[model samples]
Target: MTEIRWLEAFVAVAEELHFGRAALRLHTSQSPLSQTIRKLENDLGTRLFERNTRSVALTSAGHALLPRAYRVLQDMRLAREAALAEVEGVRGKILIGFSGAVNHLTLPPLTRAVRRRHPDIELDLTSRVRTRDGLASVANGTLDLAFVGVAESPDPSVVARLVAREEIGAVLPLDHPLAREKSIPLQSLAGDDFISPPTDGSSSMTEVLLASCMAAGFRPRIVQELSDPYMVLTFVAAGVGVTLMSSGISSIIPSGATYVPLDAPHHYMNHAIAWSADNDSAVLKAVLDVVEEVFPPVAS
Candidate 1:
């Protein structure tokens, strides 16, 4: 019989796609981790991963098993949580995934509220660079919930609800020529190299900025892609490039960096809380309810 630990290791590796990272997540070394995978593959009679020197990828069988394995493990976890809840009312762990962009506005209040209201419930908060990865984590049961920037269109397996609409602006060096302006025209930035977030183009601020730039009559010349929103300002402050960010993200602007309002009045980004539609965890539902209560609904 395949044990829970094997599935747990498999899921971790599948989600991380790198043996080192997956081993770190599992609190083990690569040699035994590889052994665990090989053992599972032998028992199942199929390869789950295709790993070479520099890269690790999921095989087709691995892809097919990922969601199912995640679901089964999540069910087991929730079963444990449910048992605890019977005694403690609301006590268990919930893993929430979010991006660095949400630090200023969304995360602070949400985490504080959860702590105050449900102290017994444990939170394992993970911050990633892109909303796409966070949402995928939520969909695959790796994360109980995720906060992400989104468009109007929704994913079929994910239930995303708008919690806030944030005004977008440009991050510029204090001595930049445009920094003195009350509002800089997006077109004026046509020639500037942009420091953007690393995104897979599935509705990220990078893609949003690109689309906006194209509408403003130019394609932004991207010079750098930083994973941390806070660190993205480092290049900007050094006069290397400028990046567009939501107004609420001003909390992390470094000393030499300042936020300049973009000229687009109608431009805004939607901040949404997303979860897998099939998530039946009571702890997950409680967090969602808290979020909905703390924020207003999306405008029609």
Candidate 2:
């Protein structure tokens, strides 16, 4: 039978890189630690370490197994905690974070679904922040989960699940000639200054927008770096510059601005739920289960 201790041992040794230190950390002796690791390697048919009297190092297979070991331990911890919380009749609180981009569409239904399913689980939603901030909070355990707008997760400790995808369009001043068209070629705005949300890893939309522009043969000259989505639109409305935005948010467009679909095909702004890989809170699992029920993740 498979045992969790084997993974725990592997992780401890992989992190410490010295069997003596790892054994000390695990409150066990070096001989037993070496035996456990050897058994693990035999079962897996791979040498996890290359060792000598002077030094010990991870083999390529060991490096590969490290992350998987962390994930397994984390999952086990979550299962155990969740089961205990249930047995103890503990009602838990979960803190949720959201980026401005996902606030309109994703949060409302998700909140309703969570409430409907896990009424005993308290959900505390944070104010609108950027995807980067939400991701950072989740990774640090300050928030349990977050709905964010990003193409990919920036941190290894944080995981992102795609929950929504929407067509992207140009946010232009109402009087801009291109705004009159039903669809605008992205390159048409090549020479125009842009008002964009911060591209400093705060939002994944910034990456999508920049990539789209580069593909269209021009780099956007951003005049402002507002972190707020509405603020970016406000600047575009005031003729500061134009920007790329999700078409689903066109309803919130300020009166002075218009959203025109980009002629580019299949490009979209993505929304994802992010959480710490190590978070073992039962409340978090409950909320995540609700997310899975209400909004199945987009197939990769």
Candidate 3:
């Protein structure tokens, strides 16, 4: 079979339309360039060019092959560039799993930082509330990392880094009587209808709120359960019922909903970055750097 060199020579001669010019462009002698073209034609079992005393012209086969050869060369160049980019940490995809609530405050800054620093990296951000599923996705190599809220310790197989502590608060309609108070006592809402996340949603904030209410000597009369924090907030704004949410969610508070800080001991929800202990992803590291920059821990 003819080598790539033969294709190059044939392409050059067919483009230049002169053996001498093609030889000069290839930095070789006319005799060798002509030989290469002849060799390519023989390999393909077809004539690619016709030569006259004064000028050279492409045969029908050469005309058909020219565009295909150019496309092949372009594709090869792009493939090489993509491989080089991956090696240089300038390209590739990273999957990030996060909670719906975190998207209200954390994702905007994180996304901007990633775009500003590593524009070539593709970020596939997914909002999921199941901590076990999120952790398993990272552990089994489906996700690069996850931003999760955990009341207890993380799985031993996963590496966890504390990102930020978001204070838990009560979300009430602005026109509600409780909105006038600077802080709402959890016990006061005992008899009122409460909106909460689904038990199966694995929301740490919901667990914290439920526990806080219990500690304060009353069980919340949960009127409805939802999965999406924004939807929960929307329901509260529409005067369906009130719910507990992270202070970070205040950033996206509905027009008619007011966020009041909890008093005394009910302060914050622990949020963290979790990934598989086996993962050594540069992209994930880049994401963590941004998170640290945006929400650095206060020293004691």
Candidate 4:
């Protein structure tokens, strides 16, 4: 039964504690503002302010109503924003995924950029996803965008754009013999146990590692498989085995581990931004625009 304007007038007077100042703050005449506050007190059956010619102060009832009235105004503003966001589509929900290796390199910057520019958009980010699963998620609408590392073409229903590249390197313990080399040869690691890449079958790093090893006349013996670069490097540092990683994660190399470049015929990891061709969300379009601006597509 209470009107919003009455509450607004009450709150302004309650805060300023002066009818004339509160009227100026509300851009209304002091008498009308005072009348509105008096009406609000009558409706509530309690005095909301204690006043004299010198100054004004809050009554016990006024103190209680102040916070409640402010909250009502806040809720109304939020509700209005929610309606506007739904209509514009810029504030709609978006799911973004990334494999672990590229999450460190790309997700951080991309997440920051999107949040800064489109603060209303809901962003959901998942890390350590397999390239195959991430691509599948995009096609099915479970994901709006995915940062994947690929060695071959993705599904026909999706578009893959090369956004970044990193030369593959051997991740080895500092104490390992190969770690001291200026540039380690792929074949030299053929005998060591390896932390294989994601088994998702779409990992270009795994393909390159196996193919490079085969070209050296031997295949790597997989001792373990890890989806996270940091985890994979942890095992390497523990002497569990040596593994291949992209130079992009070199900064995250843990203590007792280091990254050494691969010699001639060096393998590289191609990081691509992939999304379904079926996606028509305006929020998705805005994200793609930012993606292209941050990491422009590389010429094929």
Best by the TM-score measure: 1
TM-score, candidate 1, is: 0.92
Write down the lDDT that model 2 would get. Answer: 0.82
Candidates arranged by TM-score, highest first: 1, 4, 2, 3
| Model with the higher lDDT, candidate 1 or 2 | 1
Residue pairs in collision within model 2? none
Q: Estimate each model's TM-score.
A: 0.92, 0.68, 0.66, 0.69
Look at candidate 2 and tell me the lDDT of residue 4: 85
| lDDT per residue (tens digit) for residues 66-168 in model 1 | 8789888988998998888888797788898777754568887988998998998889988763677767777778888888777433457888888888787
Which of candidates 1 and 4 is the stronger one according to lDDT? Answer: 1
Q: Better model by lDDT, 3 or 4? A: 4
**Taking the tens digit of each residue's C-alpha lDDT, what string does model 3 give over 1-300?**
247677678778876899999999889999988888887888899999888899799989989988667555434444554675666855656778887865556666777888888897788887854565676666655567777665343457787677677777889988888897989777777777888877664676677778778887888989898877788899999999988888888878879998888787775677776776655555666766777787777321
Model-by-model lDDT, in order? 0.83, 0.82, 0.74, 0.79
lDDT tens string, model 4, 167-270?
88888989998788879778888889998776558666677778777877798999898777678889899989998888898898889888899888877777
lDDT per residue for candidate 2 within 162-187, as digits (tens), equals 88888888999998988889898998
Candidate 1 wrong stretches, greater than 4 Å: 52-54, 152-155
lDDT against true structure, model 3: 0.74
lDDT of 4 at 280: 64
Q: What TM-score does structure 2 among the candidates reach?
A: 0.68
Quote model 4's TM-score: 0.69
The candidate scoring highest on lDDT is 1
Q: Residue 196 lDDT in model 3?
A: 83
Candidate 2 deviant stretches above 4 angstroms:
1-90, 150-155
Evaluate residue 44 in candidate 1 and report its C-alpha lDDT on the 0 to 100 scale: 95
